[model samples]
Target: MTSTTAPKPRLSIWMRIGAVLLGLFAALLLLLALFPWDALREPLNRYVSERTGRKFEITRRLDVDLGWRSAAVKLDGVEFANPSWAREPYLVRAERAAFDIRLWPLLSGRVVIPHLALTSPTLGLQMEEDGRRTWALGKNTSDEGTVPVIGLMEVDQGTLDFLAEHLGVDLHAGFSYDSSRGEMPLDFRIKGRYQRQPLMAQGRTGNVLQLNAAGQPPFPLEIDAAAGHTRLKAKGTVAELASLDGIDARFDLKGQNLGDLYGLLGIALPQTSPYALSGELRKRARLWEAAGLKGKLGLSDIGGDMKFDQSQKIPSLSGTLRSRVMDMDDLGPLIGLPPTERSAKAIEGVAPPPSITEVKRARRDSGRKVLPDATLDFERLRAMNADVKYTAERIRNVRELPLDKGSVQIKLKDGVLTLDPLNLGVASGTLAGAIRIDGAQNPAEIRAALEVRGMQLSRLIPKIETMRTSFGKLDGRINLSGHGNSVAGWLGNASGDVAALTGRGQFSNLLLEFMGLDGGEIIKFLLRGDRNVVLRCAAMAFDVDKGTMNSRSVVLDTEDTVFNVSGQASLSKETLDFVVRPQPKDKSILSLRTPLIIGGTFAAPQAGLEAGSLATRGAAALALGALNPLLALAATVETGPGVDADCQEVLAQAKRPASREAAAGAAKAKKQ
Candidate 1:
């Protein structure tokens, strides 16, 4: 009871100095294995090259395994000559170097990094091609500050080769990191293979990245990435990222067959058909400018919004796009047309004696129409906000022809281009119109007007294959106006007016079919099943600059034949000249003055019927008196009466046969 009981609890004095420092660390690991570790290998290679400025070589079996808190140094190679970047010197070549120097966690101060193993490591990176980048840590070692954190590092099965001559990349990677969370917890894994496929990634950060680290969440982070068929995933939280001054991100990206991620990043990307993306990104930072970005993108079904200014070099964009229906014959191989069924089999392989100045320059270039460079610009185009629709069963140049419905909307500023008035129902009629295009200047001007109603002259004459003419239940109404700078000066300054009404019709070979004549005699006719053949035309309002088509009236009806047709058509060049006069249903039956030369070139025309019938004008003066047999002895010595008595009765009726049987019975009664 001497009350000095505390004297009994005497394991004190720092427990006898931790039992003599654990028996002097077990006798210095048994005298460091019989001592002669090559005599401490030159002061442990000058203390690992003065703490890793990097250049050390010490290997001859120096292994200290104090009950497995190991240490191994079997490295016959170690060279890191990047005294902060020359051109290419970040050399790291290793073959086994394991270390774990745990001296009771540095005598309980606790900054334990108990393991670091590297085996077979070789890393190389270089970039130079005017865009110089050889990261042996230079640029004055990144301006001499902040880059010294080598905690928890490991690499196994490692091999990395990267080259980026200004982005003509070549990369092969495999990496990993773990910090064992004594202070802030971090874990990372990266796997690789480039051109030959396979790549993977994983990440976790901060408060042991939660798994009951007391439900940790101070700065959670998650990441996932893949290669080959590409994929990416991300999760956020960086503790308000420096007070949200920058780096707030959300992302999701997916790709499968993005043409195999553009052939594993060699990039050529335009064989379109499989895509995916998702997004949200916001960034801000400024201290003499360095970061600012705003983004929202959702692709492959399109969506967009973007802005950038921190070295993103002038970017601005806004977007809207939706597509479901498309196929205007695949737009003729994207506008190099000549495939519309091979240009309609090259105009049906034309070869029907065709060369009347090439069929009058193919009918004066048939309404000369050509327009396609693809521009229907819109600034405020609203076809009900365009959820527009389209469908097609047929679209033809070689004849499928049914395009039952259509839609259009267009608008353009300053130079005007507006067209949103189209009400269509084609293939036998019901079309409406609206047009305006005045491309401001230089060879651009057009004014359109199309109004076709109830039009089925055999579905608009097979789209005018040079109008192989047809007419059957066609009620017409067409009014077209035009201005030009091309398309043959807009059809030589077009002027149109056509009115047709047919219940039944036939007019074949009008001098071989409407003045294309060619060896005529194929004049079929039938349009009087009850009178309605009327053609009232106009062009001579002062020759309309000589495009001439003035036939005030051309009436012809026939249940029993009656003709009173007047004409004056001179479509300029390529044959169609008329002066026909035949008004006979007994007006003393002596009216026939056909001096019609329906010329040529509208595809083979040549009709010159000039026999004004008074008996071939006396048999053309007896064949010019037998082509001057001395003018047939001067016409038989002027067979009396000044040798002109109607050419001596045309050589006495050319030895008549009842006046050639009454002129072949009145030309077979005037062709029935």
Candidate 2:
């Protein structure tokens, strides 16, 4: 047994292999410890330069620490060149930088950086107006490359210069990190110009270490920025700062005009007066929303929720706006009208400091024109599409306009805008209709159809005591179509129908006498208290063509008199030519039944007697009186042979044919 044992517990195959592997591993470790990683500086630079299509250089030394799980890389005086078109020679530079990269992914030719640190680094970023960006590396303008996953980052006294001509931003900022701030470490301050306005901004964010962590704690953020007269303040948290993902923030914004935000936010909006708003801002992929909005737009208090979706080819905006009490003047800018003056306190809710100066606006020549003449910008309409709903429970500053509540469904698409169910509560009635504006058409085309129903005359003429006792309801409709770029222009070239009718009502005899210019009736009513006359029916219809309004039929029948009106008015010229002839039901000694002519410009209308007809009537009256005083009454008329108009037929004819057809179609569709 001793002899066999001594023959050697011959070493097993495993032991022999173990001893050889140990010797080889020791040699390999020794080699790695002494290896000159600096020798790879030129080769690595060339390889990176070739991959990125940019110059890469290591001006000083390079060192690496290899481990089983990861590798630590340190570079001294490294620079990465920018695109040839860039203003700066280098896109990024660092005096000293270091990175800890995971080992496993390297086997698959992937880079996974666990940590990155930079000392005295500088970065230059730029974007051309044509949408070219220097940061899009590899192909210079191409965004076709995998970005390395970075876990944590640290920067010391970093400087960044960013320019984006399209957005009108040229900024120079300083960035730094302070570990003492705990979860919030990154801080920045910037001063430059945004939207061609002076800009100053300061912000702070959570530690970069948590930027990509799974189930990461919210990245705290706070920013206060001001540009020109606009100011923005936000405080919020982001789930991931890299892509601005999962943002939930509260923000306050103040500006001169809402439309001015287009260049900054890329959202299309109509021009508006000075405004201050606050809301909760959120982002989910390509959708950005401002919710719980409440603020002041000029003297109007506004509340709404607005959403912007960038996923669409032309981008879209949709929102619901509501106001408990809306000031009508605040809507002027939306329709290209001048804003009326209002107390600043009405908008700000407080007095401003003396340092703030009120902005002055140049006065436009009114020329006593009743219609608005401001030109519309079709380009703005073509920029984006929209669907919005607005409702006002009560209206203000409508002084004598008899407006109450209002609501409109606004839709815009492909340069065309439609306002369906544009409703206004007026004088205990409703003015309901639809309006379509095709801005895509050259010079633009507008079509409008409106209906008025149950408008009480008592409420309509609130200032007139005689009207207070009248129980009359007015019904009317307007159907118009035109091509223009302004409200005035549209009406000047408009082709349409305007009709109004009233049935089974009463009129003040005194008022009708004055309107008909009956001197005898006026004197009689003055002697005896004014009395009401039974109104059988009153109807007026106009057919408009090429801006000229021709009276199709106009008649007013009452127990006391029958009036017929005939004339043609020119909307383009803003002139009127009308004649009213009254036939009295009874005769009087002083009756002067001469026709009355109304002719003049809308700005300065003139009303006078038809002198020739009056002279003829007077001569006839005198001749008749010479024969017999009683027979002279013939000139003044005695028999009121005016037949009553078919109330139903008159009202039906007053409605425009186009509108009637549309209503029928809508009803049919609803039934189907």
Worst 10 residues of 2 by lDDT: 353-362
Which parts of model 1 have CA positions greater than 4 angstroms off?
1-25, 28-69, 72-87, 92-114, 117-161, 164-233, 236-250, 254-257, 265-270, 273-276, 279-672
Candidate 2, residues 319-385, lDDT tens digits: the string is 9999888886677667765555562334453332111122222235334455667787787788889
- Residue range with the least summed lDDT across 10 consecutive positions in model 1: 534-543
Q: Write the per-residue lDDT of candidate 1 for residues 448-536, one digit (tens) a residue.
A: 44455665555655543343434444433333234444333433443443233333344332322223221111222334211222222
TM per candidate: 0.24, 0.81
Which whole-number lDDT from 0 to 100 does residue 510 have in model 2?
A: 80
Clash pairs detected, candidate 2? none
TM-score of 2: 0.81
lDDT of 1 at 55: 53
What are the Cα lDDT values of the candidates? 0.40, 0.77
